[model samples]
Target: MSEPSTYPQPPRRGFVLAVVAAVVLAADVLTKIAVVASLEGEAPVRLLGGAVYLQLVRNPGAAFSMATGMTWVLSLIALSVVVAIIWMAPKLRSIGWAIGLGLVLAGALGNLSDRIFRSPGPMRGHVVDFVSVFAPNGDFFPVFNVADSAIVCGGALIVLLALLGKDYDGRSTKEKAKAGSSEAPAS
Candidate 1:
């Protein structure tokens, strides 16, 4: 048999990561388009026993409308996030990490798309946010979108994994500790 390949193999979970990112990005973009087309000149649509409201709101800033005049800055930050995730994908050997990073990447790309191609020009374009929880016009909570939800969920998963000592490279903190002990210098 041929000698084992010296090249490092691609991440075992890379496929899963790609699929999750694609699905989330598609859903976010589709939902935004649908909401804009349907709700532009209409009243907010209430659903789930008035727990959710669908309305059209274009946000030019970060969460809760912070930095309302800095859409370009927000766009830059989102682009950075996208770049970082893509760079780290090859090291995502854990399924949990892959899924989490995929969600984050999808979210960043979704919002970045808005910033790059939406109204008022590139890098200064507003993000399309439509989902309002509990009340319309963001009375009860800030208006959000599918991308925002994905970001929140993915961030929570990452935090949980970190707390559990699981590394994105498919190793546990405990495993690293054991390996370090084996390589310790003798007294």
Candidate 2:
């Protein structure tokens, strides 16, 4: 009698995720350092004919400048996110999920590091944001950093994958059903 094959093994998704996360984290930290060193309270640099600009802004809240003045609370939240990502990262079987989680992890760590070490008290430090986009009018988009960019891009990818019906274990619903049916005892 022939032995049945077990469930499909997960590809090298975790390794790829780890590499991507490391790159993102390094880029975020390095860019922040360069911005701090070069700008140092200087004015915003205009680019693309006022469509985009780089201005140093310190944010103590979450995305889009919401929840201002809640540094400690946000810090705790970000820490929790990081912990969750680290825990789930090892279990990720889908490349899509791995990439998504990696982005979230990198972003959380990037900001958390700033909150812990960049001036002010612990969990009270401000995140340095510099990239800005403007509308045709004088209105400006919220300033963000490399970490934020990674998080957004990763999130979008994950959402797209989910919409296509990919699961965390990297199996489609039909594939899972087929596997289950094959394992059932004969009538």
**TM-scores for the candidates:** 0.92, 0.86
Worst 10 residues of 2 by lDDT: 133-142
Query: What ranges in model 2 sit over 4 Å off?
Result: 1-7, 135-138, 177-187
Per-residue lDDT of candidate 1, residues 56-154 (tens digit): 999999889899989999998998998898888777888998999899989989999999999999999899999999999999999999999999999
lDDT of 2 by residue, 1-187 (tens): 2246566677747787788889999999999999998877787788899888777778888888888889889899989988887777767889888888888889888998988997777899999888888742124678899988988998888888878878767887677777778777888
Tell me the TM-score of model 1: 0.92
What CA RMSD would candidate 2 show?
3.1
User: Which pairs of residues have clashing backbones in candidate 2?
Assistant: none
lDDT of each: 0.90, 0.83
Highest-TM-score candidate: 1
- Give the least accurate 10-residue stretch of model 1, judged by summed lDDT: 1-10
